[model samples]
Target: MAKFKYIDHGQGGAPACMTLAEREWEQPAGRQVLIQVAYAGINRPDCLQRAGAYPPPPGASPYLGLEVAGRIVAIGPDVRGRKVGDEVCALTPGGGYAEYALADERHCLPVPKGMDLLAAACVPENYFTVWTNVFDRARLAKGEKFLVHGGSSGIGLTAIQLAHAFGAEVWTTVGNEEKAQACRKAGADHVILYKEQDFEDAIKAGTGKQGVDVILDMVGGDYINRNIRSLAVNGRLVQIAFLQGSKAQIDATPIMVKRLNFTGSTLRPRSDEDKGLIAQALAEKVVPLMEQGKCLPVIHKVFPLAEAAQAHALMESSQHIGKIALKVQE
Candidate 1:
């Protein structure tokens, strides 16, 4: 037994699955390494897991958090090169809300120079999702026009900066002036006040009615149909989440006439081999930018690990502009 705590909401109770309890963890297995977590990143999926809406994938740990950064405390026999005490940020198979977590060695990245564990913690989930959707799935190229909805969100901010850094002309929708400035500072060419303007009209006007090349969307609902209208011919709309809602009554005419493609993915359920590919791609394409301070994560706040419930409250409040993190250890 050790001084380890983890979030478990599976047991039936008042908050049921969102409860925090002490637990001892076994050593890493196969290519996995056990990490003494310093900080864990909060995400929408964590909130869903709390409410028992999103369950961990088969064979994954039954904990809430998805990503963490810390020192590697131990390594399994199959792991190579990486040794105990390596400073790393890793995408986990859940269980990041604890003092310790295990991750595949292939999924770990060195913490960039001048970055703390908190910033590193904020990187994995959002960056992995953005890279998988915006670049791999959407295939956004240099000089392409890209639009991101929910521009102030954890994943939205990362998408904005990454698209911009990759030489795309980025456009985004924000709720207020503060969020607008944040996106603008992240190199967005245009910030649509989603509350005050029709985003479809804004996209049309901003692109001279040509529409955008790709759209990275998390806001679903009517925006689904509107997203089709906002894309140019042969455009892609990658839906990563349905924050507003899903199940939209959309017209097929626009999709057919425009030759548009609609795709959606949830990263948690992806295979380890698939995630390892993403990890390698990120190491090559994105890590250098991170080292140079481009596409760095925008952290909104950091809550102590004991206050995991409060962290979820802030995420649901939708008031934060970027990633919310949990300080899990020293």
Candidate 2:
């Protein structure tokens, strides 16, 4: 057996728990492909996993990292549609922090034409997540009003660009003026400085009290009720994370009266078939936009693979305006 270097977060604690370590490499099996990773994306879930909050699903790799962009060096007997030397950015089940990683062929998307591997590495997690939650689940249509919280995040920026590209009125909430500018440049129609104004109130006033048609939210704590209140009569609210906390006490009367739908999902635990469907959708609809430069991943910073701990620390600090990545090879 061969060996490879990876970040190990033994027993899981803080960002400092992650360290460069070695493990024996395993051959790709079934539909998996062995990637000589060039870069791996850093996401909020990665930080949560490192802090012992999120755990990998059954049969998934235990290491941190959920997305990577690299070349297929080997393929399993069952693999199809991908071959050795194909350049792809993949949504990995786990272990993306390694010099080598295994990804299901179905979860891989070609690096968009004219895009670098570093930018491609930032795509899988945020794009797959936004595609599923905002489009597939929330059904955001052209001319509809959409609001996403955490406007400066990779997920937030992805949502802003996609919704705008699809002809929706995009709104977002950010922590400061710089983040507000980033969101605006990403195609946001309105940017609310959460530190200075109330998001629910802003939405109400901005839309003439009609509220938004769809809301993609990650701030769960008290924002749950505010999200509910910010929806139009037949609106949908998609909750993807709980940055503040999950539990909330809210009025249920509005849900009944307004006929609003509240739903959400995490990408990692989804079935492979479901993920494949999303990948197909992205390749068909979103990839063209990438090729046209209409919407693309916004990378904020990159760190060497050994500095994954520093990457996580930067993520948890919430200072970055877009995606962070780790350079795994060269």
Candidate 3:
């Protein structure tokens, strides 16, 4: 029997909880494909789960990863177009830390040409997120102004590059000058040092007091209303995470006056159908960009699968410029 290595959970900090262990995995069931995982992407939610701050979705695995790239080794009867020996990158509910994992067939996407498993592993979470929030939720149109918080983060960096390639004028907020420069190189039209200046003021000045047409925010707290103030008439605000506390004292006057729209979503709980729609859209719209070298994940570092805790630590330091991934194969 082939054995699988997985990140087992205990209690306390990342290293303690992110312990690696050997296990025997069950066969894939309905529409599920068994993947011999080559690489897995480390996400902030994984760290939160390790810290006991976030919980796995009901009925999902308790392991600590969401996205992976690998080869299909087995498939349930209902799975299609995915066969043994096929290479794919996928969005999973959990369990991606394992050497062998299962994924919904619809959620699996072909690894783009010229991209290896490590680079492809970084795509699903951030790519699916940015595609849904920026294009579907915010409906960001070409030539419009877009502002994203935490620009140097995985999701933010993906959003910036995608928005830029699609003809949007992208603006972003970052903590330091180095991150600001990184944002600029990633195609942001303007970079705001959120620590040195109020982003709302900077946005106002940058847009000649007109403000951005769309705002993608992960930092909540005072950012809730500040996001409102930063929008132009009919602007849309798409919130994905609350890195800061979600609570806030907000004045709704600006929202009402500007006719702004506020919406947010978490990807993990969505039905397979919803994510499948996003996958199809990305295949048609974004994969070509990857093939053309116009868009790709900026990998900051790669860690062995056993060192997931250390990877989480690096992500927490906010020192990495873009994505952090795990090399699960060797």
Which candidate wins on TM-score? 2
lDDT of 2: 0.95
Q: Is candidate 2 or candidate 3 better by TM-score?
A: 2
Question: How much lDDT does each candidate structure score?
Answer: 0.90, 0.95, 0.91
What tens-digit string does per-residue lDDT give for candidate 1 at 71-171? 99999999995899899999999899999999999889899888889999999999999999999999999999999998999898999999999999999
lDDT of 3 by residue, 91-208 (tens): 9989999898899988999999999889999999999999999999999999999999999999989999999999999999999998988889899999999889999899888889
Q: What tens-digit string does per-residue lDDT give for candidate 2 at 1-330?
A: 779999999999989999999999889999999999999999999899888899888988999999999999999999979999999999999999999999999999999999999999999999999999999999999999999999899999999999999999999999999999999999999999988999989999999999999999999999999999999999999999999899999898889999999999999999999999999999999999999987898889999999999999999999999999999996
Candidate achieving the largest lDDT: 2
Per-residue lDDT, model 1, residue 124, is 92
* Native-structure RMSD, model 2: 0.6
Worst 10 residues of 3 by lDDT: 9-18
User: In model 1, which runs have C-alpha deviations exceeding 4 angstroms?
Assistant: 10-17
From the highest lDDT down, the ranking of the candidates is: 2, 3, 1
Per-prediction backbone clash count: 3, 0, 0
